[model samples]
Target: MTGTGQALWRRVPLWGVDASLVALSLLDAWINLYGEASPFMWASAALGCAGLFLRRRLPLAAFLLTLPMLVFMDVAVAPMVALYTVAAHTRNRLLLAGCALLNAAASTLVWPMSDTLSGEDRTWTLIQFVYTLATAFAPVLFGQLVQARQDVARQLVEVEEAREHESALYAQTVLARERAQLAREMHDVVSHQVSLIAVQAGALQVAAKDPQTRDGARAIRTLSVNTLDELRHMVTLLRASGGRATELTPQPTLAELQQLIANSGIETTLAGELPPGISTTAQRTIYRTVQEALTNVRKHAPGARAEVRLWHDTQHFGVTITNTAPTRPSVPLPSAHHGLIGLRERAELLDGTLTAEPTRQGGFTIELRAPTHPS
Candidate 1:
């Protein structure tokens, strides 16, 4: 439905209740009482009850309009309900107290004990007076309670919305960081391979004698130039913005670890199988951890024997890479390299732990332990 239709639907029940109250007041003053009903008094009560229809939107007007009925009828419902509407909307304590006092005074005067009060009449009149005060005050207090409850519920909804918003922002920031890390890894791997190609191309251009061989060398150089241009473009795209896809191969998992070690040509022992139901995300983390550890070992400890161990129990999966001190040490890579830091962050995202430390045996060890299943 349209906005106006929805609003009208909400108001229909309120108006129906108001109409019911008016009808009930008329019937009570006329047909349902033990005393003889006066036509004037019954009409006054019905008119006052009509004010309930406007109480939600025009509370003060409804209260003032219905006040006369309280002065003329000994027991009434409409004025108390009208006073409740005003109290629910207004925050002024003095105004609420004054309205309650006025209704109580008018209600007490409507009784007949003011004339010729015997001892029994006086006692009954005092009890009636206390009852009148309770009637006048209870509705306003109840209205205030309703207002407080609604306020607390609204605040809870706002807090939940705020928490969700903060969570989204944190996820976006983590995604951006991961993208930058991937771009850096691609740059390092591609540049290393491209440098070797450039060196081979130069040797061909210098040594080739036949026309066909020279032409092939020139083509190889051109292809390398084009490849470098594309690499630069890919890196730019990866960093300039986020939440975009790139046509990259799927990440390696445990299946590729053997090829990784064989290609490294390092004498390393590999043991342990991945447990069932390990998440794809955790698999990628394990792959990257091993990759970074192997790269570090190759760079810093060229010919040292290394050991790779994998283990898992019902609750956890782990990887450990250890290498003896370098038989031949070389200058290390730049400190700004992100491999170890990315692995640490990757493990943390999975609620896992990664540790790289030197053992007392004069060797470095990298250990990673993560849950076997996603939480």
Candidate 2:
């Protein structure tokens, strides 16, 4: 059947199908005994038709119940359906063969007290028994075929799912290879040039006679060095190629805060200290918040003097970075403000909050607040 048709067929209640089978069996019984009024025969036929309802739950018992009708009345529907139900549910070939033989015998033989076979009658009875046996086996074979078809369908679905999963894994491997190639290019070409620029800037800072030239060269060297550190981290991540987590380098934490401030090239003062034993993730969040704040100060609030303050109470722990007004005229630089957005996301991951706003004193302040021990 087509997929939609099969789905609709399945939606038909199982009990309804059983009821329909019982009705068909009863109709067969009525047609066979149209003129007869034997109470024993009628009662056996009724019992056999009712037994169809139990076919799903008790296939063997339902088949047994139909045998009396097959022996006493000339009816085929009830016994055939019961045999099919047994074949579909069970895998024992011996049991199915025995049931088929019993069905054939019940239909072919007369009650011993009613009739006796002899001569030509005996020979015909033998042929009729063989014919009835073959007919009884028909439903059993069809039921087994249906059972095998369903098993094959289930296996096909499982194979398709496995194939899709393998394709996804192959795609991820290809992506990781491309990322590794890109990392190699950046390390060889970009890092080499940046190192040269930093070296040249350092020499210029040492040799220049003018104070402004010396300060400018020093700033360039500092920025280059910081850029190189970040590039190194990126290269390490790419080379790991989605391997084990331990293959990645250690992340920045509170211990590195002082070095970050010194390398920032901003006239930044550090104050206060957080209590010990904070989680590594929380420390990293705090570190990134301060890093983004300092970078913004250097870019947007040029020549601003900044202060980094760490604070912790019984309930919370965080860092606040506040800067004074720019000492010189600020330059208009293109920014997508993604750094602040990332900082805010990091704060949220720790169930915390980040606030960045322009102070009334013509400066900016970025503050991070998080629980001391987040659950």
Candidate 3:
């Protein structure tokens, strides 16, 4: 269809009609360049020019007027341009019907004057009369067909675009449902186990004799409890059904670092205003990291004061937990646990990094760098 439009517009025949009309108009003036009735020839030429100007706007008026104007001046010129405009722009069928009759009468009047007539001249003039009627309507017919084709093409394009948009929306809906389902399963499995670990560890801490043993158990208890709550909130969020309001649920933030440190029995200090709505994954990782660092502090350097610094820079939300080395030399550190491995895994999931090494001030520092979503 698009190819058809290009071909139709580019064809020489379609353009030739208008070009021939203009040429005939100019030829009329030249043939009567110097004549006995030069005044009437010039007047007819002026009318032809005026008809051309009004062809697109007042088409019916121009076409009707051209017939009388040409006949009165004794001119025999074709008005193919104005006739085509009349067919295309005007809606008055009677006017076109009257114009057709007047045109046939005018053509017959000039038919006797031309010397090109033979025995077939009457038949030729009749055929030409019918041809003139059809040719006058060619522009209107072609213009209508073009408009209809363009309308159909536009509709098809709109339908294709609408289908693509619907497919993309469906895919996003499927992905969101899958993510919510995974969040539910994670909550169900981890929450119960963490809660039990925290309760039992807290109970064990009460009966421990030495301060180091007590502090280690207490650290485990706090981490377990926080992990449990976080998991529970995640499950609640997934279990919700219908409407946007159901999506809300409890979660943790960096502000809870103090309570996390207290339960670890580490002398912790915090500085800077904490950001809000710290993601669940980020908070969970930070809590576990702090728990591990403080437990290591208590087990290896029992009397060493622990410092927990949590602050948000322009780019990263950081957690730096450092503790003094054991006053007595050669104290053995606690055995490595799954907590550090899990913390590393969690950080990697969020495209963050975690490092545990000795700080410049002679203490072990657990540094966590998290890419936070800005509030």
Candidate 4:
């Protein structure tokens, strides 16, 4: 059948199908036993038709219920359906073969006993028995074929899903390789040139006689150093793409927090200290949060004074960075605006939270809170 037709057939209620099969079996019984006034024959036919309803739930018992009708009256519908149901639901080959033999015997031998048994009659009876046995196996084979078809379809679906998953992983692997290549170029070429520029500017600042030239050279050296710091962080992030947080290496810890604040170019004060024995991941998270916050203060709030406060309670440890409003006019700087987002992502990996908002005093505050022993 076509896919659409098969889907519609599956949507039909199961009870409705069972009821229809029962009605068909009853009709077959009536046609075979018409005009028979025997109450015993009618009862047997009624019982056989009723047994069809239980074929799916109780296949063996339902087939046994229809045996009497096969022996007394020639009825094939109910017995064949029950045998098919048994074959479809079970994988016991010996049981199915025994059922087929019983079905053939019950149908071939009628109820009435013949007093005179001739050799020709015996030969004819044997032929009929063989033919009946072959007929009984027809539904059994068909039911098994249907069961096998359903199994193959289910296996095909699983294979397709696995193929799609493999394809997705392959794509991610290719993208990560590209990002690694880009990071290598940035570190090898761009970082090397920037380091040389910083060195040249420092030498010029020392050798120059004019005050203005010395000041310009000093500014260039500081900017170059800041750019190199940002570049190193970017390279680390690119190298660790498509992996877990623990894969990130060469990460800064709380020990570097003092150096980070001093190099940030903003007037920043470190207020408190965290207890020792913290995990590397938590320390990195705290360090990144403070780094990003200080960077933001220097960029967007010029000449701002910032304070870094580190505190811990019994359960949690965190850092808060608050900066005063800009004292000088701020120059607009081009920004990708991903620093806060990266900090938040790192905090989440350590089961932490980060919040950045404007304070009522016309300044900005960035805070990070995390569990001391994160899993």
Candidate 5:
């Protein structure tokens, strides 16, 4: 049924209850053999029972209006039910107590005269009060108990909700700690090895007799230096406050940077297609190498011609980025020069290698090789 229809249906029982109260008023008087007093007793009974229709909307008013009528009316139960409604709905203890006292007082003053009163003429009305007053105020006591139980139930629900929220916050703290630990391990283990490679490569370039071998050593040294710079910056991010919060944003992919490189004014000569199922580690390493290479060219060799080559054979997939020396080396820019070092560490993690160095003609080159199927 619709809400309005359901509400009307619920009131149907209340209408019957109200009719019963009015009929009960007549029976209480007639059963007590209150002799033919005029229609005045009937009028009072009708008015007393009728007040119940407004008890929920105007409970205190309904009780006040009906209580006094019991002084003359034969209302057997309406005033007590109205008093219970007031007690349950009232939020203020002071107000509820006052209303309960008022109900007891009205009963003391009025019940002696009403046929709803079981108490008739007795020598000790005050002693009889101890017995009669209990019945009059019992509804208020029951309603207050009901209210107390409901309050406790609501408090339990609030406590449960608070505990769940605290548990979620604890879970987040543990996850951030794990990410920071991984960053620390990279710095302690892989960073040391890459640094050693850079130093050896620098030594080899100076000692080499052949032109091609010397050039390859120079390239490896350059790549190592850049990788160190990148690794340091990445570690800093992981250790910073709310570092994990930033990871939710997507990282760049090597396969998806056509526009990104083009917009940066690098004439990318991308060759073979990246293999279909390259791992996430490979993708990130390639993207970082290209990104760092372009950045280095922009800083040290402004307006340098650049080329990118991608190819993969049975055992390996590779990318090479080479750029001519800048036309204006005089243009000043700050360089931590560690991006390639970070990329090498990434490659090492995937059981791969990356090399970077300057060409004999004063151009820079970076090459990365990742396994087709990582162990």
Candidate 6:
């Protein structure tokens, strides 16, 4: 029963096999008495046949019904069949062993003792008794072992499936966070530049001079190219898959400081060399801080002069941006933009510190420092 046909046979309920086995056992027992059919034999036959009905559901109960009949006659047909079913189906080892002992005891006690009974006859009887007991007991223990192995296999499969599900959930969470980070970067760069371009275009349209118009057009062209390049770079990164594609775009570096200053509408100055060996994350953070500061400058204090400085030692990369206060009597206060809060969060996430305070010269200064060494 190891192939596909065996698998199909296991599912089939062989009612006929159970019936035939019960009937043959009873017929042999009746004929062994060597007389006309007696009422006890008829009663035993009916009990044996009826007991098979409960074989699948209640094997132990059927076995108990046949136990008493075994004491009356050496040959009991239904008891052995019912005991075999019990040993195969039941999970109780103790109960199966007890049933086997009872059958052996009955077989020994029921065999007639007469002058004709020889020593060899008793020895052969004992051998057959041992063989019957072995048959009755072995199946139960084997069944238990098989069931245990199956249970362990099922539990292992469940554990593997749970691990895979957890891994999938973690992957989804990481992908979602990366997408949000990309969106924030795009919004920061595009929004700031577009606002500046709109203002310059409007100013150029109203100007009476040709030189100012040409300058405005040039600034507009520069901003447009910068926006297009950033967009293209982001799209390429998003489309990339493997390790090689990751290094395709030129990474942002401190060398881009001059371009960052040129893009500012407010008058700005850069001082000192940016440190080497700075992480890409730190560089981007520095750029975003400066960008947001300049955006706030244009919105809060027009025509303001700002100074940006990069200073680094063996331990830290430091950045500071400070703007002079407006000359007019009424200077606009900084708006409630979420960009400053976002910068602070970004700094904290990188294990860095950011501080912003009003300067003694009636201006605001923002400073940030991050450690280069990993702990």
- lDDT of model 5, residue 373: 80
Best-matching candidate per TM-score? 4
- Residue 291 in model 5: shift from native, Å? 37
* lDDT against the true structure, each candidate: 0.72, 0.84, 0.62, 0.82, 0.68, 0.66
What TM-score would every model get versus the actual structure?
Answer: 0.50, 0.54, 0.37, 0.55, 0.46, 0.40
lDDT of 1: 0.72
Flag regions of model 5 displaced more than 4 Å.
1-58, 74-76, 110-123, 192-237, 240-375
User: What does candidate 5's lDDT look like per residue over 1-375, in tens digits?
Assistant: 999998887878776866776567557645543675457655665566677777768878777766655555434476777777787777677877777666555655544355434456443545545555676568888777877776556545434543453344355456557767988898998799999999999999999999999999999999999999999878765653232244546666774766557876655566567778886556766776787677666556655788878778998997898998765323343333345545665677678898888999899899998788878
Rank candidates by lDDT, best first.
2, 4, 1, 5, 6, 3
Off by over 4 Å in 2: 1-12, 35-37, 113-125, 202-218, 239-375
Candidate 6 C-alpha lDDT tens digits along 1-375: 579998887766788677777778767567655565467755765675577668878988887777656655556557767777776676577887898887776655543455115665777767767876776566555655665665457545544544553454355345545655665666677656666675676566566378767677767757766776777566445422112223346654566767978987668999876677676767767876787677666555555699999888888877899999864233333234455665676576457888888889888889887877744
| Clashing residue pairs, backbone N/CA/C < 3 A, model 3 | none
* Superposition error at 119 for model 6 (Å): 13
Model 1, C-alpha of 271: deviation from truth (Å): 65
Residue-wise C-alpha lDDT for candidate 4, range 68-130, written one tens digit per residue: 888778888899999999888777889999999999988888557471145557887788899
Candidate 1 per-residue lDDT over residues 1-375, each given as its tens digit = 999998887878766877887677555445533375567666667667777778888988888767766666654667777888888888778998888877776676643545526665666656776787788889889878877776557545544544553354355456767878877977889966876786788689889998888888878877887887788778754543222133144656687888888886578889877687676567767877887788677656656778889889888898999998775434433333355666777787678999988988777999999876657
Tell me which of candidates 1 and 3 scores higher on lDDT: 1
Q: How displaced is residue 51 in candidate 6, in Å?
A: 0.8
Which 10-residue window of candidate 4 scores lowest in summed lDDT? 239-248
Off by over 4 Å in 6: 2-4, 7-11, 14-37, 73-77, 111-131, 145-375
Q: Considering summed lDDT, which 10 consecutive residues are worst modelled in model 2?
A: 239-248
In model 2, the clashing pairs are none
Model 2, span 1-375: residue lDDT tens = 999999999999999999999999999999988897489889999999999999999999999999998877778999999999999988789999999999998898776624636565777778888999999999999988987776567445534544553454355456656777989998999999999999999999999999999999999999999999999988865754332233257878898999999999899999998879987778888887898788778766767899999999999999999999986454455445656766776687678999999999999999999988777
After superposing candidate 1, which stretches have Cα over 4 Å from the reference? 1-12, 29-43, 110-131, 195-211, 240-375
lDDT head-to-head 2 vs 5, winner: 2
